[model samples]
Target: RTVTLYAPASGIVLEKKVMQGQAITAGEELYTIADLSDVWVDAPLREADAGVVATGTSAILDFNSYPGHPFSGRVSYVYPTLGEQSRTVRARITVPNPNRLLKPGMYATVRLNTSAQSALAVPQSAVVQTGDRAIVFIDVGSGRLVPRAVTVGRSGSDYVEVLTGLKGGDRVVTSAQFLIDSESNLGEAMGAMSGMGTSPQGKK
Candidate 1:
């Protein structure tokens, strides 16, 4: 009996080797198949940046073909090996390509957001980042702006998660944070401290 081989997955026919009724072997070259349900962006992250990339980390993928649109995904796989020349590890983020807008060869930009899981969060403008350290200007009593060191986590478009420096009720300056940041000398003051700092009363 003649056997008919079926296409593996749904995809546009890239190239067909044999026409209908042509003799084909069991292991003969068949049509290539691909699905857009799961797509990956080979984001090369520096060795330093690899620390922030872990499993389940959220990532935003943007494609030039579809401008002004972002597809949400997660860090599904992190390569164990790093590029010899670039010294950058390949972080594979899985994106949902429902409409097949993202093709295999299409180039795209990936934004990896890695930060605090659950903690007091504030506007992104409220925190000042200095290399490895993060500082925030807390509004103390009597129109006072106090500088405190905090461990920051994933930053959203408008907000950032405070890992340790803040609590639920603390009031922080959201707008014009640069003004307070400049005046407070926060970098020098909080730079010496550990992850979290305390108030004058010694309360976190």
Candidate 2:
């Protein structure tokens, strides 16, 4: 008996999984099919950004090749695992490709419109992160910086919303914050050492 093998979808053969005259079993993969009916954009969202973005969130996609044209889509799935190295959560956005304009390998930038609210915020670069804690330098007085511990809620490219440990009308050190953080930590360490030296236990 003569048998004919057919690809699943009418598309280009991306990779040949089997060789000619090779022994193959039933339900084995022989060819790779590239289906373009629905294009999926697997974009990675940072840990902070992922926390705000939810499934079914609307997203605007802009491709470099498309120039002015923009594509709209909704997040279909959010992977349970985060990227090991990048620490980003993977999200799948399904874009209808009836026109077949968007390809699978196309590069795109996904802008997720997250819900907004009023909150205390500061420049993202101003906060210095140490281990799992977030630290910020406050301008207490002239040429003086005080390190304050803060809890951050949501973060953006330029700004981060502060959940607590800060108040309004407080001056924060945005520029050269790392230098100030180092100095503040050093001062605190020295003060603690000096206090320990003068304690009654020091004479024991």
Candidate 3:
């Protein structure tokens, strides 16, 4: 006598637990199958960008295997918890893979499009982080580059939003800012040292 078993759903067999003539139990483990019609891509959203991404947001994914080919998807779910180490939120994007080209565990670059608003922004290279505060070099005329402290907000790939300390027409030093900033700090130190050398006139 021969008995035939059928899978509950149609899918590709991912794992085979029982071999030929090996399983005899009535309810033994058999095979693991997965439907590859659609796949979920988990993307990490920066803490600063958590507020902008939500359900139904459009996402674009690029895989290294298929260069120049982008896969479009929508934000299906956003995990409530944030990654402690990465300081990012997990957003699940549902992408259609009819051809089954996108496989599990594949690395991809995710890009999300959020609502656009007008704000003062500058090139990311223009901002210099000095441990605690963010600084930008401003062209203050007469070939002077003044370091101004700024409050930063959302950041994109190329530009970062400046909440304060900058105006619309402000010119910022994008390149060679680290060298300029170092010189400015040294000049300030020299000025302070010179002031220290001068004793009080009445006391001296």
Candidate 4:
């Protein structure tokens, strides 16, 4: 006697649990199949940025396999629980894979486009994080740069919200800020050393 087996759904075989003449048990697992017509991309959202994400939020995904090429998707679902260690919420995005280019286990970078709002913001490159505080160099006339500590709020891909320590139309150093900061510190140290060399009567 002979028996024939058939798959319930039409899909590419993802896993093969049994080989020819290897299995002879009833109700045993045989294979795993997955349809590639559509796929889900899991994205982790920062806790601070999760509030703006919704079901219909548009998302752009870039895959390592296809550099510079982006795939469009939308937020389909958001997980209820936040990652304990990562401190991020998982959001599921639905993307069509007609060409089957987006394979499983491929790494992707996701950018979500939420509703736009007005706020004081600066390019991310303008700010430097130092331990517990954030600092930005302000161009205070005559090519002099002053470092000012700032309070920051929610952040995006290219910019961060400036909650305090800056005003509208202020010029900030966006590049080579570390060099400027180093020079400023050096000048301060040299001035302090020079002052120590002087006596109370203004004589060295």
Candidate 5:
């Protein structure tokens, strides 16, 4: 039995490879059309950063063709293979283009919004970095500042997740974290030196 492949849908011929009666075979792609509605973007991410990426992650797509306009999309599929030269994985995201404003080969910036949860978080200004650890000053009461170490997780521009060493409803000194950090360091140093007159085993 012989079958003919008709144009999928009637639209302007974006690319025509065969003429009216050119020989064609089944399952052969001969023509391409430009349907700006419902487009796909090959969002790329570094291989090292692929751990946090997963399907269904919300994303915002920005196209150079339509400046100042952002389209919403989601992580449809993540390519398993990595680019040999760039060592980057191209995660495929589908965006609805009902306005037909997006075109093929246009540059796009894909932004991923991670999971949201009710975790103990503090203002960005409340955290201070001391070498590899993060420290924050908590206002216990009566203008007392208590310095403590905290484990942090995913952070946004205004808030940082406090993974440990903090609980909900704890008031943190955000404006004076740096000053508190200096005080904590001075206190620790004094304590360490105070026992210097003792044996080394006592210091430990």
Candidate 6:
């Protein structure tokens, strides 16, 4: 009787774990096969940004090794849950490798485009985080940076989405906000305490 070994899938052999003609158990590692015809790129998108991304969306990937060469891909899957550690949603993109140039463990940059509605956005520098709440300083005429709380959504490396508490044509302080935020907090505390020192009948 003759027994033949067959690979589950057709692909190039990456590594040979077992020696030729070596005795192997029923469930044992044999070889590592890689199908380089198509590649999958898994990336993490913020929960807010994930809402705008979907399957079938177009993605452009740029590899560090290959300059000026942009590979086109499409979204294959969007993970259901936002993991606790990173608070990010996973996106799986599929790209074709006709020339078999793309290899495993290569660094890549992915830009995704979807059919989602445009969101009201602001520069990331304009927003500050105070625990769960996000704060933005608005210019209420005459160089006043009024610290106001806002609801934020999906964001990129540079910009963020404003879900609520902001509107169009609003001047926001992007630079020197940290110093202003500290002063704003101090002023608010002073105002609340000033009323306490004054008597009800206007006597200090």
Top model by TM-score, which number? 6
lDDT by candidate, in order shown? 0.73, 0.76, 0.79, 0.78, 0.71, 0.78
- Across residues 31-66, which tens digit of lDDT does each residue of candidate 5 receive? 887666677888778764576789888899878777
lDDT of 6 at 150: 90
Give the alpha carbon lDDT tens digit for every residue of 1-204 in model 4: 568889899988889898787846888889989998889999998887888898989999999999999999999999999999998999999999998888888999998998898788899888877678787767666655566678987797788989899999898877534443565453442243244321111111
How would you encode candidate 1's per-residue C-alpha lDDT over 1-204 as one tens digit per residue? 777567776766656777787877778986766666788788888765677799899999888888899889999899999899997899888888887777888888888887844456888877767677777767776655566678875555687777787888988767534453453444434533554543331212
N/CA/C clash count, model 3: 0
By lDDT, is 2 or 5 better? 2
For each candidate in turn, give its C-alpha RMSD to the true structure in angstroms. Answer: 8.6, 6.6, 6.8, 6.9, 8.6, 5.9
- Minimum summed lDDT over a 10-residue window in model 2 is located at 195-204
Positional deviation of 123 in candidate 6, in angstroms? 2.1
Q: What TM-score does prediction 4 earn?
A: 0.66
**lDDT of candidate 3 at residue 201, scale 0 to 100:** 12
Worst 10-residue lDDT window for candidate 6 reads 195-204
> Where is the poorest 10-residue window by lDDT in model 5?
195-204
Better of 3 and 5 by lDDT: 3
- Model 6, residue 190: distance off in Å is 9.6
- lDDT by residue for model 2 (20-88), tens: 788889988888788777789999988867877778998999988898899999899999998889989
Error of 4 at 182 (Å): 7.2
Off by over 4 Å in 6: 1-3, 176-204
Give candidate 2 misplaced runs (Cα > 4 Å): 6-12, 17-25, 178-204
The TM-score measured for candidate 6 stands at 0.82
